[model samples]
Target: MEDFEQPVLSVRKINKQYGGGCASCRGPEARGLLKNYCPVCGTVYACRNISFEVYAGEILGVVGESGSGKSTMMECLYFDQEVSSGEAYIHSYKNGKANVFAESSQQKRYLRNHFLGKVYQNPLLSLKMNFSSIGNIAEKLIAAGNRNVKVMESRGKELLEHVNIPLYRMKEAPKNFSGGMQQRVQIAKALSNNPPLLLLDEVTTGLDLSVQASVLDLIKTIQRELKISMVIVSHDLGVIRMLADRTIVMLDGRIIEHGLTDQILEDPQHGYTQKLVQSLL
Candidate 1:
């Protein structure tokens, strides 16, 4: 029980909705519709006032099926997608007093470059396919203002090695590697800046089972070694069981239940959650 009164990351009332709302979906006059969508307006409420806290060195798992807005939430946090309305605070940023969503473009860039790291499910989104794997790591270091060529090379090698990327192939382009290898390179690059918080959006989703296990093990090792706080999104309950200390279950753009992973496993309150856990068995 570290002091979670001060969270590494605090998110409050974050909302993301696609399309304009009609009278049937707007404000106090709103009526609920099918699965986070308004039939009258064609408005999809991707995330509805989602809020959570991530404390230092703890992994918070967000589990939801496709279209549940778990991925949308991660995108919003990383600023890949803008929020319709929300507030998020990072303890390392302005002493946790500033709302990141309201920050200027320059300030947000600074936050992304220095305080946060993200691993997208698609390696193409994260890695420069043509650049040498080590060069990919160097690119992130450069963004963080590391100008020393020798230092950058050393750090890159160290990270790639940590992720089980052979130094021999460090000069190879990610485009030439297998999917799991490409993801390993992406992980190396994400850690290059030594970001305090890491956001992983379905990193192991499309990998082979063995490869997923390897990546998951590597993640556990890194969390143990670096004590980095992580928010991992997965549709797979097994992945959440293995990685998350605390788990939040999301459905139809809202969190229906959240608790200790074991507690949720042993005693799920929500019908959807019960079904999800039963599927694992």
Candidate 2:
């Protein structure tokens, strides 16, 4: 195994709660001390002290059902949402010592453009539907400071090809494409800047089975070819089994079990994980 001591991405005690942390939520001396949920204040713990490490070239899977905070965690990492507390370190950022959570808006924008790529579950959230496929990919390259149209076009074509997009459809708008095709374009655009870390939030969620298979295969191929680190969030155990080397199981916003994907599937330790695995079987 590669040395994971210096992970490509390290997250510690990240907390995301949606509600004002009232004094009552903090201490019963004010109201009644609740551990994670605060009935008095209605404080919902989207992600509570979630911590993990994603090593270089490793695909770390987060498996959880809806409202389990898996998607919330991804949102926090991508900065689409804010974190209430905790730290996140990206190895390629400021020589690996800087905390991304503490970066200024300008610095965070730079990191989002050059260091991280995210494919949201909904293409509407990630893609410019009116723009042509090539345009979508070129937008990312442009944000990364590429001014040459020919260079951007060349890179876009190459990426589209890598994602198995038809070369003839390069100039077509993504809104006209099928769901799977749109996602393929999204992946191409996300990879246009060659980000070190890729965040995939249910990329294959609603696609047809065959389409999902192709997308998954393409993702696996790209990961192997580029050796990129990825954090994939899915409730599908089969998806986790196919892509993740290590997996974390979440229940009610907390990680209940984590280990190798096979180990977690075969011998789940937590009651929630056991039920999840059994449901899959």
Candidate 3:
């Protein structure tokens, strides 16, 4: 992996909350209590004060169980959901000075099309099952302002081959392909524009163990070949161990621990982190 002196993406004090904060549950007294359902106001804190830095060509893992705010963090970064409060800066987008959270809708769309690539947990969300494999990739190219059909088709074929999809199946609809193949197509589509940043949310979930291994290997290969930065969100500690350079452990919407993947596994600092690592053993 390539090394860098500065972070490619920086997120600061980000929070995504539901419902207005109750006076009783809004201050220091409510620090740990905020993760629980606020009985007074029925508020749910999806993410509270999340902050992290992702460097170029690095794989940063965000690991947490369901409702631990990891998915929420991914969604916020993808612009699928807005943050209730905080700032995020992308070094490539604006030299890390402009707050990405404050971008105009048009600017956000531009960023999504030109700079970001995201693979959702569900192929249904990332792939257009009705479209042919080539067509699906072509859509991303078109979104990035490429209109030459021949060029788009050529690039699509190259991406499909890179992801190891058989050339004979390039015209098949994703709905007809196996789940693993569908995911490969999704990855190809996400990489269509050669994005600078890739966000992966539970990419290997629900597949056979063998299939999961292949997919993870493919991701690692892509990272090495392309030198693109990634933020991977998964509940599986093994997945983090396999792919992450650095990892952040989250629980109850707060980050409980973060460090090098080996360090976190070998000597966990937080109680929650210790339990998670032990469970993996």
Q: Give the winner by TM-score.
A: 1
lDDT value for model 2: 0.90
Instruction: Give per-residue CA lDDT, model 2, range 39-83, as digits (tens).
Output: 887887788779999998999999988888999999989999879
Candidates by lDDT, descending order = 1, 3, 2
Give the Cα error of residue 137 in candidate 2, in Å: 0.5
**lDDT of every model, 2 decimals:** 0.93, 0.90, 0.91
Residues 1-281 of candidate 3 have per-residue lDDT tens digits of: 33497788899988988888888678656853646568788888888899999999999999987899999889999899999999998887777799988999889988888889999999999888999999999999998899999999999999999999998999999999988899999999999998889999999999999999999999999999999999999999999999999999999888889999999999999988888889999
Candidate 2 shows a clash count of 0
What is the C-alpha lDDT profile of model 1 across 24-65, one tens digit per residue?
887743575677899988999999989999999999999989
Each model's total of backbone clashes: 0, 0, 0
The worst-scoring run of ten residues by lDDT in candidate 2 lies at 27-36
Stretches of candidate 3 above 4 Å error? 1-3, 31-34
* Clash count, predicted structure 1: 0
- What's the CA error at residue 25 for candidate 1, in Å? 1.0
lDDT of 3: 0.91
